[model samples]
Target chain A: MSQMRLSFLLPLVAFGILALVGGMALYGTLSGSRDPTQLPSVFVDKPAPQTNLPRLVQTGSTTGNNVSVTMFQGKPVLVNFFASWCAPCRAEAPALEMLSKRVAILGIAYKDRSEDTTAFLQQYGNPFQAIGMDADGRTGIEWGVYGVPETYLLDSNGVVKLRHAGPLTRGVLETTIFPALEALGS
Target chain B: MMIATGLWRTHILIGLVLLNMAIGLVFISATTTPAYAITAEEMLANPVLEERARNLSKQLRCLVCQNQSIDDSDADLARDLRREVRSQIAAGTSDGAIIDQLRAKYGDYVLLNPPLDQATLFLWLSPLGFILLGGLIVMMARRQRGAAIATELDAAERARIEKMLASRDSENRPKT
Candidate 1:
């Protein structure tokens, strides 16, 4: 009788475990850390991809000016991919502004018109030291960008230390970005 | 009778023709590929290269859509990736190299079919594990049920039951 009772209870125990696992997965998804959007970047700890793009031409600047990844070597820099059309890019403007005081930031205007980019920056207050124009988005593809407003932190030697897929917020800056920057002693 | 036989043969002929048509329809539908997202401008002029690109595109996931393959998605990124794949094929890059380059950039998540690795081993084998677990549970229950049906009484219990039955039999016996 005892053996029979144990056998009958076995399936109940299995169901309890399955339900617990499912509940934890749901809780993790709801809490935002396990969001589908926050995929870990494959470029972390790897050398930054080669980047040579036309500089976002300003009203008085020459068209021949270009920006490349090598130019930011020997000092920690933040490579932010943003677009004038992306709403989150606008949202993150203030955080980027604050971060610029501590670290050098290079902006890549992803797949946006120069005029629009110039307009956005004028409205948002430009914080980047320099900006690149990724007109056709080939450079964005090379950098493995799935969406706009992605940011990568590169160490002084030009290796990618961290990548945040969405807009930078105060929580993100405090929890993830600042710690990563401290790790590199930037 | 001869006329009836001729009509019967004609009916059989019609039936055979209908069956053949049904088979033909199934074959045609099975062979047709649904090229949902490929645009005319994205197709290569070279047929061989275009075929290679199409085959490769089916393997890549559209990161924007997350569920559909790049070949099936109409998103902008998917279009750009399709163009990139075509250009690589035109440049004589091998299929493995093209996939590897993308995998290196996007990680294993970009592959529509996840590669078998240490991390994915349990995922691939989970069905087998579940089936074994189910079998074990069933076997245990069956063994327990068999034991219940064959449950034996101890010597004292068996003797007491027999004695009661014997007494009842005696009480029912006719007075002689």
Candidate 2:
């Protein structure tokens, strides 16, 4: 009787063991690196998306004029995508402002209210020549923005020279962007 | 006695159902979140540095996501972690040093393949131990079964004895 019970339970025990080990192995495999490196490149040597945006603040007490893509022509423009809520944007702000002296920069306020964005620039010290409000994030999608604080370096011909997906650190601005811009000759 | 047996069966059935539900919940909790996301900024930083960071990121699992590394996940926390790695690498921090820092903060759970240490020794050894233990138990059970069969007559043996008695009774009756 005991032998019969043992025989019946052995397969169940084996299955239980198999399940435990398989579960652990499956967990390891499933949780392992799904790194984004293998995905197709989104913005490598592509032309900057053309956009005409209204200025964030009217400097001359006049109606806010639309800043067109032509304004960035004949110069390297650093198009920065940022929001007031993004912490990395705050960290990268000073470095961005420093880079502004050497290159023309335009800000794209992604998914932020105009009032909040105005307050953010006031606190962080705005480095951009013309800030474009992308209130609904549609413009950000058009620009292939995966997240905030993405900076794109555009050449004189409006072709994207490089796309930096995070904050603009001093090292990146100096080592990568500056040299690349120098190669393009302003 | 019959009522007691019925109550016991019901209690066991309920217990089994609850146990299965708990197991399902643990499995779901352990396996849901993504690992990490290595962004373009980190990739384009520097070839040598980026390679090191990428390798380390793959080795370290995200604490919140538990099962995933910071490299494979698209979670906001994962993105923040990738940014932290980029800043650290750009600042010239060594890969080993960065891992140590993360391990100190998050415990061994952060490591996808944790080192064979006192804390994680059980995790590595448990599976093999269970397999060996199970094999031993099975062998012992088989031995017990064989011993029981050798010592005890089965129902067939009892039926054979009854047949012998019946045949003897017929012979005695005929002789009379």
Candidate 3:
């Protein structure tokens, strides 16, 4: 009788073990997967980090004064991390140029030499109001930058409205970036 | 002479295996230098703070690498974060404050251990809760079955059991 009674538990225990293993596997996959659309940037909706950086010397301009992130406020600004070596940065250049006409844009040239950056700007028309040199990528770290060609939009209040990890295409600009900017009101 | 030859053969086989293992260990050790990222030049001057830095680093995630702690990562960002931690320690920042600053900057995802808050409460507790619920269901099923056996047996069923035992007893009786 006890044996028969215990037999009922066989499937139940087996199912329990299966459920446990499956649940853990699913949880691990879901948590570890960096699905780009669902990527959690810690900076979104948080205040932008303030860091002091030296201005990149523009070929045609004489302004050598350093720029600080805190100084650029009261209007929405897009902070772009780019390097001369990053291929995507070149690909996204025109899109940034297009956006710059309608919105304020700043560039942080991460880990690039001065001549290389100047040459990159010459090749791809300059779109930034001020270019900060993040030669050591220290300031990039402060801003939670992981890679080049990442764009962050800060609302007028200096709060981060959006972070796009890859190179920007016009389609993404129109669909996602524009909507967020519109909602944030410049 | 034959036994000595066999013994030498055994020793040569064992020697080859040990030699392979030693070479494997040497290669592994050569590649693992980056895992211990701290160089003498980079370590904090104070031994106490240096110890804390190592412990703190193990609790932080390497953003670029999947499932690796900053301590175990050789990525550039991981190195930057390590430098940041060491600099903070040198500047006399409290460990909790530094962790909080990083959490604020990078979010809870950067921490190796997720926080047990209201939203994540389920994440931390669900597996155990599920197992316990499963156990409870099985126990309840077992108890219900046990009760059915004692109280729900039909009269014919009871009589059948009596007859079976009676036959067993008769079979055991002494044969003439």
Candidate 4:
């Protein structure tokens, strides 16, 4: 009789455990601690992709400076992929400007024309130390960038330590960026 | 009876309508082609390479538009990916190598059909586990029901059943 009672309770116990797990997941989603759209970064703990993209050049200049990963070696830096066409990139401009004061930031203008990017920088207040032109988005792919306004933090050794997808709002800076920077000891 | 028949006819008509709608949906989906996002500029000159590129594009998920395959998505990233695949195929890169490269850059999420791995083990096994659990429960229920029937049978009733079975078996036996 006791065994039968226990058998009857087995499904209930299993359901309780499943419910608890599901509830925690839902709570995490609701609390902004988890983003349903966020994918696990394969670049984390890996060496950052080396890029040699053209610098956002002057209008009249036939030749321009090239932006490369080696230029920022031996110092922790942030690589931000942004495009003039992307609204979130504009939204995060001020936050990127604030972050630039703390850490060196190399921006890659993804799939945007040079003139538009220059105009955008002028309007939004250029915070990037050096901006690379990813006009074809090849560099974006090499960096595993799905969309613009993606930020990655690299350690002094040029290893990617963290990746944050989406706009860097003040709230994200406080909760995600600041802690990640602290963890990196930067 | 006429009213009852009319109601039954209405039910059958509704069922037929539902069945027709389901078949119509299947037919429409089968007949319609997805709007191809591959532009002329991205297409390879070699027909073979272009064919391979197209096949490869269908396998890759558009990271921007998570639901659509790169072949079917007009998103800029998907267009870039299509171009990349075509260029790589033209350059003599094997399809497997190209897929592996993308998988390495993006996680398995980039593939529409996720591969079986440690992360997806439970996802792959849950159906089998549920089936086995259900089978176990059904078996246990049957055993418990059999025990209940045996317990309900008194010694006299059991003897009577046994006697009845013996006579029935003997009656069915072939004459020698």
lDDT of the candidates, in the order given = 0.91, 0.75, 0.85, 0.88
Tens digits of per-residue lDDT for model 2, A57-104? 734221367766578898888889999999999999899888888888
TM-score of chain B of 1: 0.70
> For candidate 4, lDDT tens digit of each residue in A39-71?
778989999987998887656121467999879
Q: Sort every candidate by DockQ, greatest first.
A: 1, 4, 3, 2
Alpha-carbon deviation at A139 in model 4, angstroms:
0.2
Model 4 CA lDDT for position B55:
90
Winning model by TM-score:
1
Off by over 4 Å in 4: A1-18, A58-62, B1-34, B155-176
Question: Can you list the residue pairs that collide in candidate 4?
Answer: none
TM-score of chain B of each: 0.70, 0.56, 0.66, 0.65
Candidate 1, position B49, lDDT:
85
Chain A TM-score relative to the true structure, per candidate: 0.92, 0.73, 0.78, 0.88
Angstrom error at residue A127, model 4: 0.6
lDDT of 3: 0.85
Model 3: residues with Cα > 4 Å off, grouped in runs? A1-39, A60-64, A184-186, B1-34, B144-153, B158-176
Evaluate every candidate with DockQ and list the scores. Answer: 0.48, 0.07, 0.43, 0.44
Q: How close to the true structure is residue A93 of candidate 4, measured as C-alpha lDDT? A: 92
The ten-residue window of minimal lDDT in model 1 chain A covers A56-65
For candidate 3, what is the DockQ?
0.43
